[model samples]
Target chain A: MGNRVIKMSTLYLTEQGSILHKTQRRLVIIKNKKIIQEIPIFKIDRILIFGNIQISTQALSFILDSGIICSFFSSQGKFKGSLRPVESGNVFLRIAQYERYLDKEFRVEISKTIVYAKINNEIKFLENYSKTNFKEIIEELKKNINNLKDKNSISSIMGIEGHSTSLYFKGLSLILKNKFLFEKREYHPPKDPANALLSFGYSLITNEIFSLLSGIGFDPYIGFFHELTYNRPSLALDIVEEFRTPVVDKMIVTLINKNIIKEEDFQREENSIYLNNIAKKAFLTHYEKRIQNYREIIKVQCHKLMDSVLNKKIYEPYLED
Target chain B: MGNRVIKMSTLYLTEQGSILHKTQRRLVIIKNKKIIQEIPIFKIDRILIFGNIQISTQALSFILDSGIICSFFSSQGKFKGSLRPVESGNVFLRIAQYERYLDKEFRVEISKTIVYAKINNEIKFLENYSKTNFKEIIEELKKNINNLKDKNSISSIMGIEGHSTSLYFKGLSLILKNKFLFEKREYHPPKDPANALLSFGYSLITNEIFSLLSGIGFDPYIGFFHELTYNRPSLALDIVEEFRTPVVDKMIVTLINKNIIKEEDFQREENSIYLNNIAKKAFLTHYEKRIQNYREIIKVQCHKLMDSVLNKKIYEPYLED
Candidate 1:
């Protein structure tokens, strides 16, 4: 199953009032009774529907029957929910996962591997992009990575991870060419344009990992690093930490430094900053490209996690070069 | 949360060539270019759409947004799948559930309690309606009920439960007024009319419990007595054991004995017997009535399970008086 490679295409329905209709094997997007786009449904792998788009029940059923995942998001790209096929029928893997989650030593071992890889990736990213300007901060992050060996509890590892992330983001703030004021990492409605871009990129990557994990038959709610939180996909969160610096943070830094996205491109509403439509299109294009390059790595990481859970293999986190 | 009672209504779209449309706050069902039914959307608690029914994307979104579960079924009432809102935000409860599932002693304790109540309810049902004709079977079931106390493992308890159920069904066969021949329990396409009714009723009740458990934030895929099976909601299956005799089994007995569902009302296709449309309607009506009466008991049992998980309280199953 892991070796089989399939070309995947994602259809995004971002138009507010467009309706999705089905015609035989094709999906037609219509806005105000005007045909805007048509694609063969077989060629599409998944769909991301943004705010207020209507779909005909036939099309909805067809998508579901075809086992295509459809995710719903607010116009601002806040993930509302998703509709996926019945989860993979692999209860034994989940049982193995539950057993591992119950074992404190196993949880600590896996959590440390994840946190170590995350900080390593952060240091690599910093060295590649902003080494001269942020040398002390980068060395501080490297020290924290080494310090992870002595951390015996998940919360203590989290404490080191939190401090390292703050330093990494502070280093990132220095690398911006567009004078984007990013003092610290703020989210749940990111405050600054840099933070907003980071948050959006993280969301996209997190959703990708979430779908991948579900398809691989792991209970995405259970995790080793992230403590259990209500409605939070903790396992997905744990996996995404490894990808954060390599995927989202790197792309976000490039987007800001290359002037591909400007400060004015983001709009502020009620103390939250988000990319406007045009900027979102630019960001998504780059985001998709970066994700396409890393898709295999993400899949491999997931399979490794499965190996750790099921075969009791020592969990190894993905380290960026 | 359990104490808040709300009126619920289910809309079943069984017609093969119908379309569902949304207008403002109402849902209109159209067939053959005519409006067949129009219902206020707010009045619907859930929807069950049978084969080939088309629902507008607008209506589907409205249903999802309203937090109403929509389940799909085959024309012959086979359980297909469902669309539900984002699951409740309660990860702590799930963690507690996982911890309990991982404890061998707790698993056995809960499993024994569930199986014991299930058999006791079966005995009560048999004694209520078929006491004189099947006295030996009832006595045998009674003996197995006592045997449950000595059962130390979930599989052993399941052994007793399975034997008692077979004996209970044998007793049920003798009491049928109509010439419905149900020699044993058969499923995955019930082979006879009696098994068809039983399977259909169980499917409905199981779906109800599945939704109930999900709404209450339990991972319905995990279980105690029922070993985890691929793609199976083992937890829901465990809870439904207690309801089988009191709800579905009793309804099937009444439907068969009262001659409400004649043998002629069932149609055989390939190797499976299924209720025809009219008979399905009659059976569903009675099934809904029976479910309405036991709804509170089922909810209470779920809450008790929650208490057992969260508080480590003694888990008790609901037994018929």
Candidate 2:
């Protein structure tokens, strides 16, 4: 909103048993009392800490109080949570947001816009894989989008979304050469490598949107499209629907089809699959690249939502051309 | 709301340049690489870190994720901020709270209740010190309470509160053996030892209420009596009003009258006064004792507030008998 461009340097602390220490103005990564890496604190925009990493309270408090976004993830890449600094001083915007959420008509209308954009992005993403014939699946997705227009309640919209997602995943399987590893979409414990990638990518993007929305002073817990779940950033989830295909999904396709990520890159544990450390690094590289490219589009979509809530403007979701 | 009582063991880290390290199930406090103190993590309910104390991220995250409240303070005992865990999953309660805040009549009614309780407690506290004649000031406070019944807005209510507080502190000066040091009330940089104690005590109690209210799922930012300011926990401040006299002021009187804290205990820095390390340790001991004694009363007061918000019950403030 201020037209100030922030250069994002996301520092990932993936090494287990490493300590993040503060030395003067730099963050030093120490392992077994040896300094492994060091970076100036000012250059870092955000920190993504993986499992079992230790950071000094001085460093933790410094980063938090400095207003840097710090998020935590499990070793397997599940989003644990983030340490948010004291909230912004914008109570009026939150009140406006609550008013919109309270209004059923406005809620339904915004949900429709979000669902429409999500399905539209899905179709465009599938269509980009020119080798695959997603004609039947695209028709089904379009039908689901049309079905969304008549859906009144959030549950019904979610029903249509669920149906479209299943079909979209079916379409995705058709496009990937490594289709055997991804027969269907399994969420909780992604049974296969592709599902694992999807879940991880979604978690990363959702965390991004959560930080962005909070920075913009919106209550990310309340949402129109997503149900108000306990401790979930529902509004961020809602906004992230539009970005799934353009940001994460498209990148997932490239990772698989380009052989950028190999089958062996995944490791299986008790029926759940996850990217190995090397594969996660590769995945993050592409993920960060995709995010950089689409960051402006993401900000614009967030602004559109703010306008919808604060100015009674019709919410327009981001759809890839 | 749960009848399960939490035994509060507030672990205060007062040693400057100390590191809080996690050793299996225990927290080890190390100063100059020497173990100064060790406590079982389970035995600790909350941690208060003061000035230059470094904590390992492992310990900080473990404490926070385990729902233990951790607060930070300056070396001179100024409340910096706290690290709160993820919020409770009670969106509906917050919505109800916002609706009440929006209703001008309900807001005004609740503010009156809170202010009435606060002034009543102040009078009772002053009355408790029999060595002083605060009868005229008590009468003036009663007048202020009566004046509150007719006030329709927060600002005018604050006006009454201001006048009553002046009279109350004037009464406080009469009760204190060391009256020359504290002739009047000063807030921002408490000019004298009495003001410093008051500010520090209020901060500790206010933080306690903030954590309690948040744990009960109330948005601590919104309030009835206090004007919504940026990053200030207004609702906590509002609730803390009823606590100021009973919890903080009474303790201040004891500290002064009993010579538990000496005049020389305070350190002066360019017109501002603060409690030194030894005096702070003494103050925290008594503060914790008072909190333990009044914990049930505090919880009941919180429940009364919850009932008022959720059930539209007439909000009754906690008045000292």
Candidate 3:
């Protein structure tokens, strides 16, 4: 849909940062950059620090003053604390908003958030699917994609596609290593050892999707169908669909194959699964490195994609089975 | 967190002029605030509209001159394209960096991100949980929270006494109406209609979380436990957990009990239930308005609780059965 810029291979920073998402921007400060100690860029929204980073009150004050999000982590990549800006620092408002959503307007807003998110996501996915396997998938559009093209309306196209895509997502377990399957649908508090991994992984993957969408400057929550309830990041889910296979599932496979994460990393008791501290620590190492190592592809000389999308460059998303 | 200032909500207008997203700054926009174009800022990344809320050639040239991210979104909130200022647009370089993560160098960096995000989100959630229920949920911590003279390690005391807090979240379904049975570890492709509601509702709630997290300057993607992966937003989930029950679930009960929504809205097919388009749209309209509606409370001002937290003010969270 836009100009194409693909960064095929690059080294990602092993450290991590917070997910500063917005309708128009994603602000991320590399821990390695130590921007916190440097002159404050009050414009940057999220500052992510990892691997034994230290900070001063001045930096913290700057973050607060600028209303930037400052998330911290240990050298081992454990999440530490957040320095939320003032006014936004009110956690009680979050609770009250939560209360209101539950009491006054749950279904109307919550459902719409999900619905719109489904539509936005499915539409993007189908368009990509169409371009990627244009010949093959398009042929099955009538059945697998619920005949989306046949619909004269965009809403109909999105609705039909959303249902079909979800079905595909639900069936992903069959293709994945069963140990990695939390089935979310089948989770009885997960009598299996991988339950915690799945839960954590899904949540992780969803957030990553949110960051990417925001970085690309899309609304992370103003979804079409998903209700716009207080503090819900529907936009994150809206974009996560296409990447789940590549970011979460593929990483799971790689983690398992490399012994970066083991069955022992997960614990099961009475049908519920949890990640032991050690297992979590081990898995976290590999996961952190993977994202920092991630890089996008781009044309050698073209801001053309970024500057003028009038020519319409195609971007095929990364998909991993 | 810091002090919050009250500002009137402004209607968003994209493509009116140059848009700026300063790093480390929370969601505050230093817009020329004089412009007014009702272009919903839903998915737009600070649209610098020199002409027709669009990235015309002149605008692209200016962005290229400035070396900023010129992000674009469709009016319907779809992410359309981006423009990197040539003066500073090294998107090609950024892509090269992304590709490096594909190499072995990526493993360690990626894994670290996952570990830290997990810790951060867990801590944030726990901190919130302890703040309100520390005394009641865990009697041992009561002395520290309730007693102003207790200069002891509030977190440590809460940690030891707040053991049952986990049961509160994990076992919430037990307290709800039988219409929604959150059984022991149910896998969440979420088969039950209630489960579907839970999933969808949680997503919306998380968006609200994103708004606050971003407004406060936290990177939604550089999460602690959630892996940094292409196309995922780990930070969004981290923020979502803080309000799941208080917002989405509560709203769900209200909808069902108040008869605002009916069984007819949900269509059960092949054992899976979904909301029809009409129902879904109706839900979003209401949800948006609800989010727009704000309440006043002690220690909390106009914005929701999440904002208060970001602003760094002391506020308490409340829960409803």
Question: What lDDT score belongs to each candidate, Candidate 1 first?
Answer: 0.82, 0.82, 0.38
Evaluated with DockQ, which candidate comes out highest? 2
Over the stretch A1-321, how does candidate 3's per-residue lDDT look in tens digits?
011112111111223332222222222333444432112253343554443333332333334445454443333333333333322222222222223323323323333333333333433444433234333433443354334334444355456556655554444334345666545343435455444454555665454443443334433443322445444555455445444444455566566657677777765656466666566655655555554443231121112211212222332333322
Residue B70 of model 3 has an lDDT of: 35
| Standalone chain B TM-score for every prediction | 0.92, 0.90, 0.42
Docking class of 2: acceptable
Off by over 4 Å in 2: A1-7, A32-36, B1-7, B32-34, B131-133
Q: How should the candidates be ordered by TM-score, best one leading?
A: 2, 1, 3
Q: Give the fraction of native contacts in model 2.
A: 0.38
Q: Is candidate 1 or candidate 3 better by DockQ?
A: 1
Give the per-residue lDDT digits (tens) of candidate 2, residues A178-277. 6546889888888888888989999988888887887787878888889887887789999999999888878888899899998888888997888888
